[model samples]
Target: MAIPTIRVGLTAATRTMAGTSAVPKYSDKENGIIATDRETGEKLYTVMIFLMEEDRAETLKVTVPANGLPNGLKPGMPVKTVDLVARPWANLFNGQISSGVAYRVSALELDSGE
Candidate 1:
């Protein structure tokens, strides 16, 4: 059976650090997996975003292929998550099961002229 995923799009602030090394570092075998670009064979990184709605605030962490994110993206910069999807995952841990949403995006671009 295929896992169902939700497609979502919204304007949010990029909370991840911005620089030549904006991507977070992780061991190749950490979490029993390694993230890489399939077509370009490049490493991937996780980006954090903050969504502010009225008085409620939420945060999401998404993985982006190396150099996949748009340039000039910085902290507190308004941006849009292009082709964003949320996949639900469940795993057995110790003696219990846990589940959460994993986010991915094809690109992150500045939400200008909004």
Candidate 2:
């Protein structure tokens, strides 16, 4: 059973926070839980990006490397993500199936000339 994924590219209007969900300690081996580099031990942070879809505005949460996000990235600033992927996740809770999309990016860069 392979999870389906889709490649995507988007511009970010804002970045909210960066941290791990694990309490007391953080590890690099956990998948779909904590994002981190295997060799460098650098943790990946979850970033919330505001975007415009069609005629409406929406927010997307993506997991990116700690150093991958640009410095001084602020609201209304353009962001480019390479190898951005949207993965579908499903789980059973209370005898019901729940599903959602999980986004991740391999690299992030500030979009200049915007």
Candidate 3:
């Protein structure tokens, strides 16, 4: 069972945008093993959410399944994004603001035959 853990504290982003080589907000090292209901033997892995300086309040969030999740995740639920980028807009007042929530995408991984 691959456990979802929280990564160590990282540096904050500056007012200016960073290059492509910028480090990630969270890493696999922060994940850990957790216990769920004892009698039912049901367990769920919990992963940490990261909010970096570059990640504006409006940035989109997405969650992707690893090698687990047999039934697959639900759409419009919530998940972290595989990658983050500022949406392009001409002016500051344009659709540049961000919400603090992340959206979900389904049928990404986990299937009998790809």
- The TM-scores of all predictions, comma-separated, are 0.70, 0.62, 0.19
The order of the candidates by lDDT, greatest first, is 1, 2, 3
For residues 1-114, could you state the per-residue lDDT of candidate 1 as single tens digits?
Answer: 776889975545422332232465354665745567666776777878876666666777887776667776677766666787999999998989998998877777776735
* Candidate closest to the true structure, highest lDDT: 1
Worst ten in a row by lDDT for model 2: 16-25
* Candidate 3 lDDT, 1-114, residue by residue in tens: 432333323243412111121112233435744443333444433223334356553323333233223243343223323222222223345668644433222213222221
lDDT of 1 at 4: 85
- Global lDDT for candidate 3? 0.31
Candidate RMSDs in order: 4.4, 6.2, 17.0
The alpha-carbon lDDT assigned to residue 22 of candidate 3 equals 16
What ranges in model 1 sit over 4 Å off? Answer: 1-3, 9-21, 25-34, 37-42
Better of 1 and 2 by TM-score: 1
